[model samples]
Target: MTDSNIPVTEDELHAYVDNELPGERLAAVEAWLATHPDDSARVASWRAMSDTLQAKYGAVADEPVPPRLSLDALARPPRRWMMGAIAATLVAFVAGGSVGWIAHGANTKQSMFANFTDDALDAHKLYVVEVRHPVEVAGNERAHLQQWLSKRCGYQVRAPELDANGLKLVGGRLLPGPSGPASFLMYENASGERFTIYASRATTEATQMRYAANDGNGAMFWADRGVGYVVSGPTDRTRLQHVARLVYDQTEKTGL
Candidate 1:
């Protein structure tokens, strides 16, 4: 059905798919769906595509830990003590020559996680505009989404409620993390502006926050407890941080 023919606006359809609509607005959409079966079918098809996406990538978190990640192997000493000393000396020399190298490894890890955040934002930018198929799992199926993602990520997944920030639980997706799988939960404002919070495990340090601007998208990344989180959008820095704080609070409350 065309936009004009449908009772909901394209933006509303987008919100519906994102689970941004609620209360009267959500009820309105339900009422509209009751009268417009074709539109309902279209929405269903779109949701199916989201489901397929989740099926394909969601399990990345659940994959067996790679052999390279074996702690015993990593902790094993070098075969030759002299050779190990020499290697350590060489590393120290390299670290001394380039302070950036010391920071580089940590920076590189952050960059890798940042790239995942970019992917999450890209997915949000792409599918949020879509009238159909905005999410693989609907908001109503949130419990199932949580169970599935938590199981996959090997951590409990809790959907953060953001009503205080004028955002609500839209739904979440499981994405790949640095070591394994990660999670991305999206929220939006009434004006259709959207923001997303992405979290994964960090190898370097405790959660800290950094701001970055990439191709007009502003992102803020932080690590707390064990998970690293990145919040990104086209919105202003202050607004982005506001949203990030909400995410942080919810995540903290969830103990994730």
Candidate 2:
């Protein structure tokens, strides 16, 4: 493994999984992955998934082109939504479960929530211990921070009011999301306990709140008006949900 100054981005991780990383960057990513066990594990999962998919679909790709599936078929390519159905078909075929998923689309809540919660918790762990510079813009600049994040994310963003829950805004920062850019807002209470709320673009309109926890950290995730939100902290589920509910309520009032 070699080391370099340039840090690898999420796109590079995907490229590494697909064997699409440029020659100049491939070794650097490998070196980064060598030292980053968590990222390496994620890369391994994606590689396994890709291998499984290829093993299942390689024969389909090799099959002689059928008359109905000729080059002309590309003229009337399926709509955007159908792409998900197609992916579901491939997953169902490779995974050997839920044959009906091909028709139902690829909106598995469990997997989606896992991704959201994992990202949120990872961010929380990375910044919560910082004594200074935890956020790019301090809570004193709430309006500016919100505006900057909303502009970068291509959506209206706001720092939800959490004072009633005994949490004051600690400020926020930008992050790479599964879809695009995301916003992470940190808040602290009088006890010095801190929590973070992470929001990103989502495919669906609504979702029931879901809870997840590990190593004394807990999070609640949900979706509303095309944004998925996850609130995470080093607290129990009951206390976390209490704060999550407050976040959800305030976010809803913004109407997006």
Candidate 3:
């Protein structure tokens, strides 16, 4: 719609919603929105929600803090038991002649999917707010993205199709893992709610799923053959499990 030939992008739309885009790009976005009713509605809804949140909570900064929340009152010296705990941990690592601290329990019988769960949730929080460059490869380049990440990670990485559900793939990227490379895939629904799938090489032969909750997010992590997969989303346990089943089914069918 504008003189520029460049097509509108999801990042541009997000920036427009958050008012982060430069002034020069405003006209192009508005012009694009004019022709796209769906995007226009989405933008309006986002703005309304943003305005409501700001209006409802914007005054908290000026209010007097509650006694329990006072920083000075809450400050304290570290617990005495913590010192002994640290010393014990150090001894365990050194005596075992292992990779030390970080990998102290690597040989344990526990499922290593727990580690990927934490990483997946961290990645979700980091990239969810990004207005631009959310992924190294966009969904439109699905084939190339799969090939590129697969080669980089030493596995056959396939983008799980969730289009049948309300969610659609946004894109994916390559990320570092505990031992090597990892692949991250992002998806979003019409309501702008998002989910992420992170995959890396397996550290254990665990095929059973591991469920974990952290902060405000939840994940279902598992390992099949040589690959580990984690599906992460908000802390709605039932909903996250539902989405996890879809991911598990798709990846299991093409896990190679």
Worst 10 residues of 3 by lDDT: 65-74
Best by TM-score: 3
- Candidate 2 residue lDDT tens string, 1-256: 4346688887889888777789999788988999999999988876665564344333443444433223343345443444664577687788877756644544555556877887787777666655345688999999999999999888989998888768999899987765667798999876556789999887678999999886467899999988999999865888889888888887888853
For residues 1-256, write the lDDT of model 1, one tens digit per residue.
Answer: 5433557876676578668876567877877888888888867765665565454334443445443223342344432433544465578677785674565555555554565456555544444443344455666787998888788777777777777767755667765554567776766554445566667665545656677775456788777666677887764889788777777787788876
Which structure among the candidates has the greatest lDDT? Answer: 2
lDDT of each: 0.63, 0.76, 0.72
Per-model root-mean-square deviation over C-alphas:
11.6, 16.1, 9.5
Could you give the candidate ranking by TM-score, starting with the highest? 3, 2, 1
Mind giving the per-residue lDDT tens digits that candidate 3 earns over 104-223? 344331425545676677776666554346687889999999999989889889888889898888899887664467788999776667789998876556677778887566888778
